[model samples]
Target: MTASLSWQKSTYSQEQGDCVELAVIGGAVLLRESDNPAVVLRTSRANLADFLQVIRQGPAKNSPPGR
Candidate 1:
């Protein structure tokens, strides 16, 4: 169950205010916003890795300029 998983918030998050948290459960990764813990998003490790990689890469090619 999610209650047993150890959720961690990013250090980049502000000291106060809601932030996203991540947890690893078996072969899946769990994510939830601090303000709305009940609404959790679950995905595989590979998918999460790919998503993060895209975010780090910045805007995609063929997209509008300066957006």
Candidate 2:
């Protein structure tokens, strides 16, 4: 939202409006839904990394419909 960080859409973003955006600001991770970018969620980089590792090892985040 501010000029401090740049937000990028999730690589796994889908066409049906299921989009995730992320930014790194002030040594923390910021996340928002592309459909509604106003609401921001903050988390630690370490926590985000751990969750990503689990998701990467377990299941895909945005699997397309009927795949």
> lDDT for each of the candidates?
0.92, 0.82
Can you tell me which runs of candidate 1 are displaced by over 4 Å? 65-67
Q: Tell me how far the alpha carbon of residue 15 in candidate 1 is from the true structure, in angstroms, after superposition.
A: 2.1
Model 2, 1-67: lDDT tens digits are 5446698888777767668889988889899887787889999999998988987796556977654
Where does candidate 2 have its weakest 10-residue lDDT segment?
Answer: 58-67
**Any idea how many clashes model 2 has?**
0
lDDT of 1 by residue, 1-67 (tens): 7788899998788989789999988899999999899899999999999999999999988899987
Which pairs clash in model 2? none
Candidate No. with top TM-score:
1
RMSD of 1: 2.1
Per-residue error (Å), model 2, residue 65: 20
